[model samples]
Target: MMKILVVDDDPNILELVNIHLSQAGYTVMKALNGFEALKLVEEDFPDLAVVDVMMPGMDGFTLTKKLRTEADIPVLLLTAKGELEDKEKGFLAGSDDYVVKPFEPKELLFRIHAILRRYDKAVDLFIQAGPMNINRQSYEVSVGKKVLLLPLKEFELLSVLASKPNYVFTREILIERVWGYDYEGDEQTLNVHIKRLRDKLEKLTAEVIISTVRGVGYKLEVSSS
Candidate 1:
């Protein structure tokens, strides 16, 4: 069974979430604070984490930031603060999704399942194209002799394209697959991410690998050289 860690200081909230998650057939781990959450992460990494933004010590933002540094575990931030800035902060802290307080249990379950599904689909079995090598298990991508450290989204995007080299994928399709249906962001977000990926890949080879199809989408160039 997939394991999920839920971090919240509210006893009632913890118990309620635990019951719902259990019903959904997940192994749930509970932590009342960030310290405990960190410990739980160190001991055993969960498939995903549900974190409350407001806590006594070490708020959700800090914990999420710390977690992102070590693992790419999907994080869903549950918070009473519904301000736009608060949501932005959660995203900046590496949360994969955010949910406000007083949310329905059914909605929460759906979000959890969706995030897991998206994460699972983001990576392929493996990708070997040209001089590049990708290991889905370790989430590593290398170019020729050099190992490149790519951000999670960038790596996933490349993996998707490289999985089927030369296949053109529309920007909308790429955004939906990479960012999830629940993603509430502008299309410019995808553009920026693609640019970042291009910058990183350019360091490895002078020739560009990702090609824009102009008003259609993008595809990995099948090098003739």
Candidate 2:
């Protein structure tokens, strides 16, 4: 079973998360602070960590940075504040995902599963496009705590574009990459997928934009701000 470390100052939150994670078949390690969390890491490395932002000594951001730089561990940040700035700070601190307080237990479980799946491979099979996070392994696209379930074709199309943001990919190349060379579909098929992706992205997140380069093809652009 994969090991997961849960860090939060509150005993109630810690136990809540622990029970859920344990029932989900993960080996749970609990910590009340960053110092204790790091000590646990030193003794036994975990596959991932679920950290709360507000703590007495070292905050979640600092601890996340330490886990990322020191051990290269993936973190899912939990915070009561749902402001955009706080979310950005968590990402900047190298968190794999972010969940706000009063979140549904199912949502937390889903994000954890997605993060773990992304890390299961040798090479990182995840894409971070500003506020949007795409998991190639799980076919899940998340913007903050909102997870978007996409069709296989749409997910593959989005993944290809996100793999190289701002790089224009010709229609033929995209078709081949996503649908395979054996695909008998024409350019209209690609156009349909592009349209669907554009609609979804426009509705879901402004951070990631799918732009059509008239003559060339489509390019995915990620907002830095």
Which prediction has the highest lDDT against the true structure? 2
Question: Which residue pairs in candidate 2 have backbone atoms (N, alpha carbon, C) closer than 3 angstroms, thus clashing?
Answer: none
Question: For model 1, what is the alpha-carbon lDDT of residue 41?
Answer: 92
- Which regions of candidate 1 fall more than 4 Å away from where they truly are? 121-225
CA lDDT of each prediction against the hidden true structure = 0.82, 0.86
Cα deviation at 4, candidate 1, in Å, is 0.4
Compared with the true structure, what per-residue lDDT tens digits does model 1 show for residues 95-121?
989888999886787788789888883
TM-score of 1: 0.54
The CA lDDT at 3 in model 1 is 87
Ten residues in sequence with the least summed lDDT for candidate 2: 116-125
